[model samples]
Target: MTDRSFLDWPFFEAKHRAWADEVEAWAAAHAARLTDEHDADGSTRALAAAMGEAGLLRAACPADGKLDVRMLCLARDILARHSGLADFAFAMQGLGTGAITLFGCEPARDFLADVRAGRALAAFALSEPEAGSDVAALATTATRDGADWVLNGEKTWISNGGIAGGYVVFARSGEAPGAKGLTAFWVPGGLVRVVERIEVSAPHPLARLAFDDVRIPDSHRIGAAGDGFKVAMATLDVFRATVGAAALGFARRGLDLTVERATSRKLFGAPLFDQQMTQGAIADSAVEVDASALLVYRAAWLKDQGTPRVSREASMAKLHATEAAFRIADRCAQLHGGLGVVRDAAPEVLTREVRALRVYEGASEIQRIVIARAETAR
Candidate 1:
């Protein structure tokens, strides 16, 4: 129903196209089971398991351990089109375990298998109450003990916080200030306590975590003590574009619902689509969707081509696509008139989901700064 012609773009290979088709089919079959209004956490866990069973998670981590950004984008795009919760489950799995996949020791590999199989939930704990886009401002600390590391700080807004089997926590561990002092640890959920469960407009298993001297074995260290910042940035570089793809999916779905409504609903004794104003809105939605796809796929393609770091491209894609999707969702809601504002309506739900995308990963303001920095450096 959404635009499949984008698959023909040179950005994707034959295998990527095949994988996209397969994922879309799987999502179609499992759409109902992927979302549950009564139990958000349970549904997320179930969706992760289903994705693992369907072998869709293989794209999250290939045999060679190299992350394929294009495949990741494809999966997110398709899954998001079907269910936002499903996309959340899949993205968190990839993100939570990404540090281990890219930099973990042999022991961390064992945890990743559980993650891929959906037997264990994973989370990324980098942001704190005080530190968000400004990673240098993180206050979490990891102090060395005799043979272990003690984490003592709080992480808020963590996805899969209460349910994750383990977390890739970033903390200050050295004398240097800012990001240079940070370290990454793979801490089991048992070591930390869920201080509070965060409820958002678009529900997911988010929580605030408290680490009261949580002890973890030194083996759980992801990289060198000073490598946490690098690890986090690298992981984000790979996933940021996929966020845009997810936004694109939401925008595309909103557009489709709008088209269906306009064509079927009539006003003033004619179809709603008959109005020039309606036509203008539809045209704007189409352009925004296509433009978002172009930016998203471009970033994915460049990452796949072995660009060591794609901060500029990734930020551009995320900023443009997320902003565009929010606007498109708002426009769709406006077009739907009274029905759009009703609870659980397609446009209303999409508006909430798309709004969060603009804030997470890196906010639009941060992305603009990143882009500006890169341009000035050039």
Candidate 2:
């Protein structure tokens, strides 16, 4: 119901357009039952099951083990427009299982079938209390013990934390310092304990996990011991552009709400749309939305076209789209006046939900740094 005209852009193909329409239709049909507004964990579980049953999770795990970045972006964009929670549910499934799809051994690959089927939920455990954007600061350790690795440490801000069936956990395994010593492991969720459930301004199934002598076989290790950083970066590089696409969804929805309010509401003996200020806000939001779409699809397109890594492009897209979405949401809230401040009002809720997108999956500041580094190197 928002604007599908963006699909006509050259960045997408006929198949991408068809897939986008299908996802939008699916989201519309299922949005009402897909999320429980009051229960983050419950809603995530239910949404995952529903997405699995619909075979939508297949986009997250293609048969060839190579994810279609364009399809991923299109799906996230459409789903986020319908429901932020739905977008979160879908994004986490892809992100949580990404390392496995990209670098896992046979056992890790076997888990993908259950994950895609929604019988098993997946979690990506990368962030810790001290290590967030700074991956080199991670303190978690996985020590070798004969055929198994004993994992001991804590991971925080984990999506699908308490509810996930398995986790892709990164920890220090070698004597080398910094990211070079880190390794990625596939740990069964039952082996770890959730220390605390986190509640955000926008509800999500986030938690802190503790690993106390948890043992996973060497077969569960993803990539090489020193390649954890590469695996995590590669996984992130692929999905980061999709984050921008999700922000575009939120911005599109916010702009639609603002347009409705502007056209229907009256102020100073005239329709709100007649006011220059309202017109400027709408125009600015539209431009931002289009700009966001351009950057998001550009990154996705580049990756799909065989660019080994689109880190710089992905960072720029995420940085701009998330920041622009936040601004657009704020403007929409302002245009709504007192109605927007109502706790659960559409614009208010969107504003709150979009706020977190700026911080997660590499914060805006980190994105700036990445861009600067890339530009300077060029």
Tell me the whole-model lDDT of each prediction, alpha carbons only.
Answer: 0.90, 0.91
Per-residue alpha-carbon lDDT of candidate 2 for residues 1-63, written as tens digits (9 for 90 to 100)? 488898898988999998987898889999657676798888888888888888888988765
Candidate 2, residue 214: Cα displacement in angstroms equals: 0.6
The ten-residue window of minimal lDDT in model 2 covers 103-112
Q: On a 0 to 1 TM-score scale, where does candidate 1 land against the true structure? A: 0.98
Error of 1 at 339 (Å): 0.8
Provide the lowest-lDDT 10-residue window in model 1.
Answer: 55-64
Question: Each candidate: how many clashes?
Answer: 0, 0
State every prediction's TM-score relative to the real structure. 0.98, 0.98
Residues 1-378, candidate 1: write the lDDT tens digits: 687999999998999999988998899999666698557899999998998888888777555688899999989888888899999999998999888888865667777888888888899999999999999999999999999989899999999999999899999998588888899999887888999999999888999999998988889999888888999999999999999999988888989988998899999999999999999989999999999999999999999898888999999999999999898898889989998899988888888888999999999999999999999999
